[model samples]
Target chain A: MLPEALDAYVAAAREVGNPSSLHASGRHARRVVEEARERVAAALGCRPSEVVFTGGGTESDNLAVKGIFWARKSTSLSRTGVVVSAVEHHAVLEAADWLGKHEGAQVTTLPVNAAGKVDPARLGAVLEAYGEEIGVVSVQWANNEVGTVQPIAELAALANRYGVPFHTDAVQAAGQVPVDFAASGVAALTVTGHKLGGPIGVGALLLGRDVAATPLLHGGGHERDVRSGTVDTPGVAAFAVAVEITIKTQQEYAARVAALRDDLVKRVLSVVPDALYNGDPVDRLPGNAHFSFPGCEGDALLMLLDANGVGSSTGSACSAGIAQPSHVLLAMGADDDRARSSLRFTLGHTSTAADVDALIDALPAAVERSRRATAWKTPR
Target chain B: MSGGVDSAVAAARAHEAGHDVTGVHLALARNPQTFRTGARGCCTLEDSRDARRAADVIGIPFYVWDMADQFHDSVVDDFVAEYAAGRTPNPCLRCNEKIKFTAVLDRAVALGFDAVVTGHHARLGADGRLRRSVDNGKDQSYVLAVLTRAQLDRAVFPLGDSTKAQVREEAAVRGLAVADKPDSHDICFIADGDTKGFLAKRLGATPGDVVDARTGERVGTHEGAYAYTVGQRKGLDLRVPAADGRPRYVLSITPKTNTVTVGPREDLLVDEVTASKAIWHGAATPIECDVQLRAHGEVVPAVVTVEGGTLRARLLTPARGVAAGQAIVAYQRDAAGGDAVLGSATITAAARTSVAPEAARA
Candidate 1:
């Protein structure tokens, strides 16, 4: 947590008032929440009315995908299908899946190229094939696992041209890249707090006023009736401060973080010669470096590095605690074996040259041990 | 853990003993959610949930490791091939021999754990050799006898000192919901307990003759000769009553001719049994030991000898229902009611005392 955000959160949390109440303290609490919402809206280049507060990135994404799909249903039944990129976070993918399974909606997941980037032109092809049936198209601005930035501008423009709403889960790109909802021409964009520098459990979906989104939750009618329940006052305040500071310093922070990430990737690859870089080389998040080690299992390598105090991920862990092969790698045409042998090291605000040096120092022996564990174990 | 009271109590005991413990339930089924007919059963999603909840009550980390591919290749496929070769294979022994003791134990060690713990009703003595459980009625040393010395050294069974009733009581005390869970029986992969149907679907249903070994007369026809076990009497479906007014029993199965040889019950008694794929815990040859033919089956007082990589046991009293491809675990006498396991071998053939040895050949 950032010091300023932490201090503000602590100070605000000491007070007691529900932002939805009509009393004096409640009106003051409502003012604090509205100020936070306005700051978030201005920072992301959207109107204050466009910001719909929710629990976090996941909730915001669920609302945009499912809510938008439902709203489209009210206007037209023939156009009730959802088209999402293949590498979406499980949040959006699963929401669309639920809409398909239980809510009677058709879903089409678009494929990605070898670099983990969706070709913007594919939207034209999909529109031509299933135009009236395609309700909305969702493509993440930048992937969370591989950090491959998609061509969101062209993709969103294509969706708009086809009179379909476009939604982007910009949780990974909000603070790391320049994200402007109005400029990107997207109907809905999702952003969260903790991914950058804010507290968790507070985020907003930038919903265009012209875009229709039915409520995911009902009661008391919050966030233009798109999301329900009382707004989180302290959480929103801290989230606003984090968003303001991150965007203000994004250029400098990105430059320093990307350099450290690049150095870490280059030196580590040099040490482990068989390591392969994932995602797009030129177009990627400044703080993300993902790799596939030829003979090592991702979890084994992660544990080895974690023991050395270097934090990493083998894609994302599900509820079962099983470290499955990354779907992002498979979407890029990697085989199951290759997909299973992946690791992602993400740089953040606190990353430094010393951290990269530490990773480079500890990677060789860890790679050796991980390879020794799984190299012969794959034949079965 | 097998997601029963035994393993749950074993993990709790290990934790109580101040050992850093992590409970791992092996996902043996390709799809764990596939429940068997009737009640909750082995390797189903329900078992995994019970195992996880048991770990939660015990306050230890729990994980489910998917061992389906390893199990299919080692235990399940080997079982099919063995039965098709006219041998009645024990799938549990194969699981203990290949999957649990070898694959899972090796991975547990590689993952930096000291030992693998289970609910097998077998004890590891202070001498580090495996002995029969104190609960003689539920002793599991027969199936576990296939484990080598190193595997025994790294294996722990906390239920060895307690009876099944006591284990269930301990589980109840620990607030485990599966305390009264019924014990899982039969081959886990055979969901319906119909070994014949499961194998028929895999090996195909081929009709064969059930013949009288003594008279060389065909008595009944069977869908598959491999489906019959030695000493089985009820399912023979004989065409006529025996000449001596006695019931017939399956003496041997010959896969090549698809023939099942049946005769009077005496033919099923074998005083001499030969085995292969021999594994020993101590010396290669168990000098004088009690050999058990089946899991939870009788222990035959026998003299064991090994020559040219083959094991032969000469029983002082003939052993009944001895079948090929089953483990013959060797045990030695101890102060306890049951003997201590010395080693084990897979049965290749068995011989009755009076019959011409050539006639015993299927």
Candidate 2:
């Protein structure tokens, strides 16, 4: 049934038409693209004109950052500064770093608390210091690995006071949290397809009509000339469907997943009493549980769990091969050893109570084995 | 667990003993370059998976322990610092003393396990004394000397009584995955066996000179004196030929002088060496034993003495090029046959002879 929905995607994928072209087939493709934009915008509480399709979350982030920066700086070269939260995904952080490193733009990364959420007051202070020079300010809607939900509304309001354009990578938050684009009042926002059961190659940047953004990909002008390329009609349609399904079922989904996540935490802590939960206890993502077992190595525990027919990531799956301690945990003031000993368990729409139960059943022995295999100097 | 034939047989023997046994491989490599390309180290991820498969065939569980951080701090960093201070560090010794015996053993005890087992070719005598493995060619008593009594109480070496050939035959009979896995040599961290490159990366490239001690003339320019050890002779960029035209050996590394003292090969021998940080496996005090300096070096008779945390051993026969920071492991012959570990220490300094000629042949 899921593949059938993707079959419709495949049929639409075969036809190539520039949505910006004014010809008959182009108009038909344009209508399909517009319909997808409308469906997605309605689901997220935004207008159809506000939706601009991009390659994926990464390209969306790059376009939003570089575009916003260029637009702001073109108006006033003095406005060449960007402020971002320290816990942002590498897309934003790396892009900002590139600007700072080569583009003569000064980037200030705001520090986060132990819970991995940036203080709005700190953002306000930073804005006050360099408000006139600030080109763009970004903070993630929800942390990808730790599941810390940032107060995006509060951050947006603070940015508004300084007249600095704010952008949020709502990639991890789109279906998991309450993301109302119209209510948030942010100049730009980023959302990807994969995290919410959409096609992998599709995503959109929600740009406020008044906001100015330079085009990242240039060819035939498309998506209000903000992002230029032939649109993936099938991908965009499937993404719209996924977003609509996710948003409609979010409340019930969140409740069920949160309960399951809570049960996992309770069972795990019951077995390993000294397990340290990383991220905010209550204000975290519904299906994300990050924990640190003091003497047990995370990779060791992960392998043990895999041996027991359960699979979980040792922190971020993106940095899978690098055995170094997580940069995110290190930024949160965790020691190198503790950072290396942490694991991340993320649940999606496919997760079930039975899955949680299986994990809980196998966790005790796995933790015991891993702890024995890689002991530390301390007893815990 | 599966890297060498010994560990493979050890896992089998432990299972045959009716204990619920599981094999664990520690992943300590930070990069692919740090991995043992030809099956030399026991800590690679691939080796861990192989161990897991071997355990599966034996109807037991297996796991890979991520010990990258601890290995970096305890072994790699310590090695760099030791060499920077003009001492030759043994990383395998540090790893055995810290990670395998100490950290892993402690965790095994806490997990309600009676013992942690390994394939190290060393034994425990009938009186529960640490002994040399029956396989004389594979005896690892020197490295095992740092294990404390409490650690040995929960330690089991299954290959202690077996020869290397017997271990391979046993593994082949049992059809284990890594029965043919080659023994790892060189420092595990130095994948390409480039100790110079490893040290240069750790301690920055500070160029120095290797000079003749008697002539005070520069014999060769070196990347750093720290890169050259006590007995190294080749790869010194020497331009001038000695009067005898013999190749010069690095007699000493003077980090304070930023100079490598070079002389003829005979100058490398030393009759006395002092070691500290002694750890006795079964006994509380020092005892007379044969001491082995290098891993494959010949055991020489020595009278061991200890006072206030310092241990000094005077060799009955003059030893060669005994470098500081290397382990001097004491081994005694047990009554039941096989040698027992007395203890070990890090050599802090060696006595230099006042007579230059005598020093050259000491």
Candidate 3:
């Protein structure tokens, strides 16, 4: 977290009073929350009333999906279709799946190209073919795994033409990229605090004023009846500070990290010549560099790198902590071998050239060992 | 570590002794997500959690190395193949030879680790000779005898000097939660301890006849001849009783004809054992040694001869129920010190003395 945001959060956490109370202490707490909401709105270019505070990006996404789908289904039973991209995070993907299983919704999953971007033309075609039946269209602003930045404005425009609500989980894009909820043409956008240097468990859903949605949590009738519960005053205060600062310095952070990421990628490719750099070459997140090392198991590679003082992550981890091949890579037209051999190295504000060099120094040995430790199929 | 008291204490001891210990639990189960009802299995979801928790308490990095595919291909597949060929295969010994010693150890060495430390109840002398543990009842040298000399060089066994009780006490002292965890028994992959049912699932039930060896008559029927092992007295469910009215035991299984032969317990006795593909720790020669025929089974005094890559041992005293497909691990007996492991081989055949005309069979 940013030091300023952390200080604000710590200071607010010590303060007493529920924002819903009618006493003077309650009024003070209410002012803090309201002020934080306005700051969040101003930074994201959304109306203050549109900022509905949530627990985090996942909660915001769940609310925007399940809440809006339920609300739409209640009015027009025929419009029970949910359109989502193939590379969405499990939060949105699983939410759509749950709706399909329990709510009798028809889900249309649009596939991505080799670069992991959802083609806007596919969205237009789907909407034209099944416009009236579709209730919501959701595609992430940026994929968390491969770091593919989607053409959200075009897709949102296509959904708007069909009179369908568009929601984008901008959790990965909110602070790293320029994300204006009002300008993006999305009806609802999800953003969280942790991604932007704020404390975790605090986020917002930027909902359009006229967009109707049912509440997932019911009681206290907070956030214009979209979200409810006693407000997290400290978390919001810190979130507001983080949002304001991250946006103000997004350009500089991106430029610096992009250089570091590029250097790291070039050096890594040189060391491991057969390594395939995944995702978009130019349109990916500046700090994201993903690779697939053909004979190396991603789990072994990640652990070896971690042992060498370089921390990275594989595509996904099941409940048992077994690393399954990345679904993102699989959606990008890669085979199971490629998906199982991929790793994502994410650079953040604290990353440095020394860190990248450290990874470079560690890559060759880690790759060689991981290749030797290949998937249990070596001929005896 | 195996998520048991012994392994947890082993890791703790290694770390305390100034070694850079990193705890690794082998994720050998093909599907750890399967909901298991009992604690009779290893590498289950519960075992993984216990291992991770123990690592956390010990203040070391922990990882679950997924050896499921390797284990399935080597140990599990070999187990089914051996059974189909009418042999009672010990999967634990196969695992020690193939998965742990070969696969995991090779990976560890490549990853810059000095040694792979385990919690097996076996000792390695200062001169690097493999020996039995102080805890005789829990000694695991028989299974570990399958490891090659090179693999043994990079292996560390920390719980050899202590008994099971001592390890449990150390775990309790160290506040490891698995201190009271029940010891895993039976085949781990067979969750319910139903070996026949497990084999039947893979090698589907092939109906066969059970014949009485002495009378040379069909006595009963079986779903699969692979399910019965030599010397198995229970579950025979024999339809015809012997003339002496004694309980019958399985004598042999012939997979080609899908026939299981049964006889009186006296016929199960064998004074000579022959094993193939012998592995000797150092020098291979004729020696007077004790041979353990199966895991946790009795060790018998025998004169062992190795020739043409085959081991032939003549037992001084006859051992009942000696079966093929089990290992015959040779040991040099040392009463005051733990017995040294000479080497091992897979039992291929066993026979009684030819002088005993009525009982002898090959």
True contacts kept of each: 0.15, 0.33, 0.31
Candidate 2, residue A269: how far the Cα is off, in Å: 7.7
The DockQ figures for the candidates are: 0.23, 0.19, 0.42
Worst 10 residues of 3 chain A by lDDT: A371-380
Q: Residue B6 in candidate 2 has what lDDT?
A: 73
Which lDDT tens digits does candidate 2 get at residues A159-229? 99889999999999988988999899898999998877788878999999999988878887767988877
What overall lDDT, based on C-alpha atoms, would model 2 receive against the true structure? 0.81
A1-380: candidate 1 lDDT, tens digit per residue: 78888887887798889999999889988998999989998899999999998899999899999998988888888877899999999989999999999988889889999999998778789987887677788999999999999999999888888889999999999999999999999999999999868998888999999999889899988779888898989998999989988998999988998888888888978999889999999899999999999988887778667767898888765443456788899999999889988999988887888888889988988887776666335544
Q: In candidate 3 chain B, what residue range of length 10 has the lowest lDDT sum?
A: B353-362
Stronger candidate by lDDT (1 vs 3): 3
Best by DockQ: 3
Candidate 2 CAPRI grade: incorrect
lDDT of 1 by residue, B45-69 (tens): 6677778888999998776666788
lDDT per residue for candidate 2 within B1-362, as digits (tens), equals: 63556777888899999987877666677654446465655555566667767877878766555557778888898999999999998888788878887666666565556788888998975577778888888888777777778877878888888888888878888998677777777787777778888788878888888899768898778787788888888787688888788888888888997899888877776667788887755444445678888787788887788776688887776677788888898888664578777778888877644445545443
Q: What is the interface RMSD of candidate 2, in Å?
A: 5.4
Query: lDDT winner among the candidates?
Result: 3
